[model samples]
Target: MKVEIWSDVMCPFCYIGKNNFEKALEDLPFKDEIEVEWKSFQLDPTLDPDQTKTTFEYFREKKGFPEAQAKQMIGQVSQMGIKSGIKFNFDKALITNTFSAHKLLHLAKKYKKANEMEEALFIAHFIEGKNVGHIDTLVAIAGSLGINTDEARQVLTSEEFNDEVKNDFSEAGSHGISGVPFFILNGKYSVSGAQPVEFFANALQQTYEETVIPLKNISGGDNSCDADGCSI
Candidate 1:
C-alpha cells in the first residue's frame, strides 16, 4: 500500500503527525510492504521569500493575533510537540516562503530521499531556526542528505520541479484538503490532521487488508496439479 502525505515544512503539526504515523507503521506486521510519499503544500504561499520574522511576530502581525494570544497559542503547540517527541522553537523559527523548500523536496524525491528531505526541513525550520527560503540553506541541507550539492543548487537556482510542486498543490485542492499533515492511504482512505498513533495504525491495517490479497494454497495433499501432470 502507498501512503501519500501532504504537509508544509513550517507546520508543527505536520512533523508531529509524521512521527506518529511512522510509529504506527513500526507496529504493523506488513510494514515492509508500505510505501510512503511526501507531497508538498504551502500554508502561506504569498509569504515573501526574503521576509525575516519570528513565528510569534508573524502571527501577531499578519494574523491579527494579540501578543499574549500568539505566545499562548504557540506555547500550546510547543506542548503538543513535546508529547510527539518534537521540540518546536517557535521563538527562533523564521517566517519565510516555503516555495523553494518545496522545490528542494521535489529534487529529493527523484533520489527517493524526499522523506529525509522533509524531516530535515522540519528540523531546520522548527528546531534549528534556519531560513528554508534561502538557496544556500537549501543547498547545505541537500548536501547533508547526500544529494549532489551542485545539482541541488542548480535545481533551486532554476525552475526545476516547479510543476511538480504546483501539481501537489493542485492535487491537494482537488482532494478538498485545506490543511497540512493530511494523509491519504492507498488513494482510498483519508486521515486528516495530527491524529493519534492508533488512528494511523487502524487506517494502515484496514487499507493493507483491503488492498493486499494473500494467495491461498488450494492444492490438496498429494493431489495438486504440477507442470507435468495432475496427481488425482
Candidate 2:
C-alpha cells in the first residue's frame, strides 16, 4: 500500500508519528511491497522570515502560552520522544520558517534519499539543535547525504522547487488537512496524527489485502520501494 504523510519538519508529533509508522512498516507482512511518501505542510506559513527568535520564543509569542506552560508541553513531548528513541531539545530548538526546508526535501526526493534526509532533518532541528532553516546548514546536511553539494547549494540559494513546495501545501488543503502528521493510505484509508504503530499496520494490512495479489514467489532476495500507491 501507499502512504502519504503531510507534516512540518519542526513538528514534534510528526517526528514521533514518523518513527512509529516506520516501526510498523518494519514488521509488516508486506513490508517490501509498501511505499511511503512524505508531503510538505507548513505549520506556520505567515511566520516572519527575518525573525531571529528561538523556537521557544516563537511558541510563547505566537501560541500565546506562558513560559512555564510551553516548557511543560515541551517536557511532555520530550518524554514521549525518549520512548520512541528520538531525542528532542525543546529548549534549544528555534522555530524558523520551514518553507526552505520543504523545498530541500523535494530535491532530496530526486536523489532517492528523501526518506533518509527527512528523518535526519527532523532530528537536526528538533533534537540536535541545528539550524535546518539556514542555507549553509541545509547544504551541508544535503551534501552529507551523498547529494551533489553544489547542486544542493544552488537549489537552496535559488528559487528551485518553490512551486512544488506550494503544491504540496495546496494538496494538503485540498484533502481537507488542517493539522499535520496526516496520513492517507493507498489513496483510500486516511489516518491523522502520530497514532500508535498498531493503527498504521492495521490500516496498511487491511487496505493491501483488499487489492493486492500476494506474490508467493519469495526468493528471499527481492527489494522494491515503489511510489505507485505511496505519496512521499
Top candidate, metric TM-score: 1
True-structure lDDT of candidate 2: 0.76
Tell me which residue pairs clash in candidate 1: none
- Model 2: which residue pairs collide? 2-229, 37-231, 37-232, 38-232, 55-94, 55-95
What candidate 1 gets wrong by more than 4 Å, as runs, is 211-232
Query: Model 2 over residues 70-151: C-alpha lDDT tens digits?
Result: 6776777777788878878877787778888898899998987889888988878887888888888898889889999899
Residue 103 lDDT in candidate 1: 98
What's the distance in Å from true for residue 96, model 1? 0.4
lDDT of 1 by residue, 106-135 (tens): 999999999899999999999999999999
In candidate 1, position 150 carries an lDDT of: 98
Best-performing candidate as measured by lDDT: 1
